[model samples]
Target: MACYRVVLIPVDENWTPASPDDVPPQPPQPNERLLETEDFFSAVREAIQFNQQTWSERKGRWAVVCEVGCPGKTWPGLRICTPLRYKIASIWWPPGWEPNSPLDMPLCICRTHGTLQEDQLSYEQALATIQALNQQAMDRASTMWYVMLAVENEPVSRTISYDPAGLQTTVEIRRLHVAQPAGGGHGDCSHCPARSLDCSMVAPA
Candidate 1:
C-alpha cells in the first residue's frame, strides 16, 4: 500500500454575493497550485479506487455511491473553498444546486488556509474519521467537505469530498508493505515505494 497524508477543508455554505451574475468565478485555490490535468485525473481515479478498496475490504461487498464515471462528473458535495472556483470551472461540469442562495456556485472550496492532516492516518482511518466529522457537522446545505490526498510517499496533492454515508471504524489493513522498486502511473517516483500514484513531493516519516 502507498503511504500518504491528507489535508481536510471545510466548505462554508453561507457565503453570498449580490446577484447571480455577481457570483464568484470558479478557479484554483488561492496560494495553492493546480495539479496538472493528467495529475488531477489520476488523483481522482486513484481516490475512487482507494475508497472502493478500503470500504470493500472493511465492510465487505458494498455498492458504489459516487457518480465517479458519470457523464457529467458530479462532485460528491456542493460546498467548496472560495479560491477553488476557477479551477473547477476550468472543467466541463454542471453547477451543483445548493440551498438558500441563488448566487451560490457549485464549486467546493472557500479559502486555502488552515489545512489539517495526520500522516499516520491510513486510507481506512482517514475515511472513517472524515465520515465521523461530517456526521457531527450534520446535514448542512451550505457547506461541502474535502479531503486532500497525499500518497504516503507521493508529492502531488489531490482533493476528495467527505462521504457522510458512513462512519465506520475497525479497519483491517490487509496490505502488508514490502520494499519495492519505484514506479507508478506517472513513472518512477524515487521518494517512496511505487504505488498506483507517483511521488514527487511527499515528505518521508
Candidate 2:
C-alpha cells in the first residue's frame, strides 16, 4: 500500500534565493497542518484542491509526500514546484494501474508558479498523443515503449533535497511494493509490457 502525507510550508517574505540558480529553501519553513492518508492519489488530489482554494493567495506551498523514509519526511516527496505530469506518471503507474484512456489521468494545478495554463496545454497534448497511440496495433514488446515514451517526454525536477531535520512529529516510513497485475486478463497490467522483462535481471537504479 502507498502511504502519503501533506505538509503546509509557511511562506518567507524576506527570504529570497541568493542566486537565480539556487534551490528552494530546505525543508521549507515549518510544516503545518500535517495530514496523513493511505491513499497516494487521493492525497495528491486533495493537495491540488487545497492549493487552488487556500494556497493561491497565500505565500507558501503545500507538499505531498510518498513517505519513503526521507529525513523529516521531506525531499523524495512532491512539492508544489514539481510538475503535475511527472507526479502522475512517476507515482501513480507503479502501483499496477493502467489508464483506460488519457482521460483517466488527473488534472494538475500549481498556483504558486502560475503553471496551470502551461500544464493544462501540456497535459492535453500528452493525452492526445497517448490516445492516438492507443488506436495503433501494438506488439507486446511495444507496450512498454508506449509507457516509456510518455514518461520521458515530461519535465523532471532539478533536485530532491529537503531539510534533513524535516518533520517534528512521529512518522513511519516504509518501502513501496510495486504490485504486479494479476494474470488471466483480470489485472490492470494484464496487457502491460512489464511482464516481458524479468525483474530479477533488471539492476536497481
User: TM-score: which candidate is best?
Assistant: 2
lDDT of 1 by residue, 47-125 (tens): 3343334433523221111111212112222122111111011111122322222212223222333334534444445
> What value of lDDT does candidate 1 attain over all alpha carbons?
0.26
* lDDT for 169 (candidate 2): 47
Model 1 misplaced regions, further than 4 Å: 1-37, 41-106, 139-146, 152-205
Model 1: how far is 147 from its true place, Å? 2.7
- Cα error, residue 14 of model 1, in Å, equals 54
For all predictions, the C-alpha RMSD in Å is 22.7, 13.7
What lDDT tens digits, residue by residue, belong to model 2 across residues 1-205?
Answer: 5355656665454545332112244546435655677655445455555655543455555443333333332344342322233111222233343544423321111112111122322334544544444334122312221211111111222334446688344333222111111111112444545555543211010
Q: What TM-score would each prediction reach against the true structure?
A: 0.25, 0.39
